[model samples]
Target: MRKNIQILQDIVSRKGSSKVLTFSIPHVFKALQLLDKEGFVSRATFAKEIHLGEGAVKTLILHLKKAGIAESTKSGTFLTEKGKKLTNQIKNTITKECKVKKSSIIQGKYNHAILLKKYSKMIKTGIEQRDYAILYGSSGCTTMIYKNEKLVFPGNERECFPRDAKTKKYIIENLCPHEEDVIIISSSDDPFVAEISAKNAALWTIAIG
Candidate 1:
């Protein structure tokens, strides 16, 4: 899976003199996720769903095709067998998620918390996930790990937001994370942005693994 993630990370970069990619590593996964859910995707739909312009979408589709991940036709773009395997891998890794209500601990009007399975060791200060979410245009990301029946920040055993039991209980009940699982909460004014932000940060965690 790490090798495959490295492959995905590589695809986001320019190959020699080729055009610079307008998408990020997480956008590649999100695109695959869209195809896996919808089965097929048109350029316009892809642009709208992935929040990219038509030219960027066009190039993105081209890259997917070149990578043997997807194919396009009159119906639209559909994942290839290889793409299906990769998409399923990603879906199974994420496990579960939930919508979070605005609270003092949350930064924006909307929020989403995604559960990353057994990747707590990949966290280092939880700063990388925040950087990833911010780079993806979200307000911020809060990364916490489930350990010893408590939610805590990485690199130590300190409980995260221990004073905010209400929010902590909400997250614990909804996500149901097991030991070593990571919980990433992303916040933004736009609900969709919040969702993608958490997902992008989750992808970063997975790739880092």
Candidate 2:
């Protein structure tokens, strides 16, 4: 889960080396596209929303130009019809790796204990600001869905662990999170990477919010 700036930089440098761009480029446009759902957002406003400095933000705009997906103007940068169409394609294709759901703004605080020190920086900054954030971390490829207090995942018992179940239960029970709060979950066969994805998801949640 690299930040928008890093991702944008990668997109620019990685050009000609790879036919495909990093998912972050589309992810950024997706955020802008969502922000623009109602209309265009000022450069300053968009920068704040995406958590990037002015220079870094401008760099992103430039990358979008190269892709021919975004258009910039005095009013601000916006997704062209081309940008919007590409965003949808990316969401259905590239972004399928993780799913995010946002509920109406609700009450309660995040459980800091679940956060690991190495990965705590972004979440810490988010919570400190009292911004909405949900940290979802899990090991294994099993997907956990909570509906009506039931936890469901794909796999045989051996494929999933009781600890994983416990972790999910603890998150749901302790957080008492509202549907409005952003819930970000990421899974990988590697627990460490999954943790990274979850943190990235947390950042992504804030970006979209």
Candidate 3:
């Protein structure tokens, strides 16, 4: 079967909590951000965390309240009982997906993991030009394999993989790549594809950064 077609199908068919995890909410990020900051943060801070306008933040908070996941008061916005449980559930799922198996680490010159953002499409083209790429991942993961080549990504479920220049630098330093190495970037939100692709490798070192 064609590897690309199969991978596309798998991405479309992923279901249940996996789907929930795939289509993350903008407001959820804000709520989680507040949760991370001891369960309360000012509106301006919330807006800054999610990179949204002040009016947009207010609207999102209202949405969160309607969804029974958050509330707002003089103290600040906070998660409700349901919200905490949901957040925990999401966290647990991501943790399970991202768990790196020791067996997947391959020994070679070097294997690079990149958080593909500006260069994702370019890398995909490079792999295709080189010929034959086997692919994997659920809705949130993207894994491609070719002769002596492998790529693990956070799929295309989101509009774009979250990133910045600082994040990119961090990836390079951590992955410790060499010249001509294949840099595969994955989202922390969905690492299942990358993890599975690495573990399933027959050759080549697949490193996740």
Candidate 4:
């Protein structure tokens, strides 16, 4: 299974330009066929759903198109006759493949083996040396961070405020201290970070991982 994943990763990373010199297990091939049946997935969505990198998905799409098994329109992707037929013929195989892939991803995330290794390295570098870490982003963003490592502040309590201007200002003013420095972790560069910092008279620092 690991070998198959490595092959798929290579194929996607190489934009399917690499020649298939190795045999992919029947299960892996079936899973690819099933994904092809689902027509156009956005780069981000595909990465999030399949646990593959965006660059790899882009390459895989290109390769699938070249193989005449998939057709990608602007909005989404549709399976070609070949792709649909292949998926239908190998329905059982595809189901097994999907289960295997899903299990692998779930295990990876639930165990936090890979993610925690990365976070532990970051923390060791003094990146987490702060009085408090203000994770200002969507709920999904905060959840992902919490999954990677245990939160030190709030004593195991996770709080999320609505993304409203007035409420945001109030939270920053109350939670942040003027004299002490706090670290700000944002998924993106947005004005909300600046607004929160300005309101609290605190400096916003980015957390690099």
Candidate 5:
């Protein structure tokens, strides 16, 4: 399951009625209550955000009513004070429980030429449909520039080598051009990949997920 914090962020960012809370449905009332208490949303707006029909939203409102976390008024459904407090408590509890430390970097050389060629056709199709560029990179820093099936840089020695923090920094500084996107795959989690990703905000990083 996705972490509650992520779910909460999604709910807060979505626009519409307070019914967006219904999207959290069975699982996200606590967060929804926070949005409500903040006056950031209304029950009907929440329903619209979640794409629920009026009947489904009404059912959820009934449940919230029985729990005493919500009340209906001429204006719209508003969260009760208890509901607001509970939402704050849930946010704090989840934040405290969900800290993750960064992991160490691992290195392994990879030759993406073959994979690039295979995906080239697909990429070309996309480019033909819509203008786009195929951007590639690696944590190993072993990418050899190729043109016409011939290696450009690094000549004959195309094998990738493990890079320490200093080496990774140097490779990125020298190799990654500005405004270029990169694809990173490594034997282990590489901080360099993260560093590059941060530096180039336009860059897109695709991990296994």
Candidate 6:
């Protein structure tokens, strides 16, 4: 797993003379997810789905190709065997993600949550995840760890959203999180921003943890 994280680090990190990247690690993983689901995707399709411009999407494809993770053919763009394996590995770490309605915990119009597998030990204050989400264009982020079948904020033993039972029940029933799992919810007015914000924070946690 550490080796896989290092591989992603290289994709996001700048070498001595590489062009400045407009995209980040989350974009890379999202692109991989798209390819894994669709099998083959076009630059236009990739741009539309990943929320990147054509030029930036092209550059991302080049990076993936250089890493031997994907290739472009007459049919469009498709992941290589290495890319598929990497995507599966990433899916293992980030178990599930979904859009959730605004609730007492996250009060934005649009919210998304990402489940990071067994990352409770790496979460100290959760401020890091929140800061990352804010930097990605969100008001704030809520981080919770699943323990004793309930979601609780870091350093707090009590259950989160105790005052909002409906939201709490929905989260618990939908996410189906296990013990030691970490849930990160980011909120924004824009739906895409909300999704990206949550995913970005999750990626940061994986990168640093």
| lDDT leader | 6
Task: Give lDDT tens digits, candidate 4, residues 139-170.
Answer: 11111122222222222333223233453343
Candidate 3 on 1-209: residue-level lDDT in tens?
12322222232232342322221232343246456557887788866655567766666665567667677889888888866766664333222122321112222122223222222333433333112112433112223321122223323322121333343334445544333343432222334333333322211121111
How many Å off is the CA of 196 in candidate 5? 30
**lDDT (tens digit, per residue) of candidate 5 on 89-165:** 54332221111122233233221111111112122111221111112123332222223332222334332333334
Name the Cα RMSD for model 2: 12.6
- Can you tell me which runs of candidate 4 are displaced by over 4 Å? 1-39, 92-209
lDDT for model 2, please: 0.42
CA shift of 13, model 3, Å: 22
How well is each residue in 1-209 modelled by candidate 2, as lDDT tens digits? Answer: 23443433454564654434333533464454454474566668756555556766666677777766677778777777766765554333123222222111111122221221122222322332222212323331222333334433322212212445555545566544332222334444444344344544444433343
- Using all chains and alpha carbons, the TM-scores for the candidates as numbered come to 0.87, 0.43, 0.39, 0.33, 0.33, 0.94
- Candidate 6: which stretches are off by over 4 Å? 14-18
Q: Give the higher-lDDT candidate: 3 or 5.
A: 3
Query: lDDT per model, in order?
Result: 0.85, 0.42, 0.39, 0.33, 0.35, 0.87
Candidate 4 lDDT at 168 equals: 32
Off by over 4 Å in 1: 161-166
For candidate 6, the TM-score is 0.94
Clashing pairs in 6: none
What lDDT would candidate 3 get against the real structure? 0.39
User: Could you give me the TM-score of model 1 versus the true structure?
Assistant: 0.87
Candidates by lDDT, descending order = 6, 1, 2, 3, 5, 4
Tens digits of per-residue lDDT, candidate 6, 1-209, equal 66776777677666674678888877887888899999999999999988888888888888788888899998889999999999899899897888889877789899999999999999998899999999889887999999988889998666897788888788878788999999999999998889888988998788788
Clash count, predicted structure 6: 0
Q: What is the lDDT of residue 102 in candidate 2?
A: 18
After superposition of all CA atoms, the RMSD between model 3 and the true structure is 14.7
Shift in Å, residue 177, candidate 2: 18
Answer with 4 or 6, whichever has the higher TM-score. 6
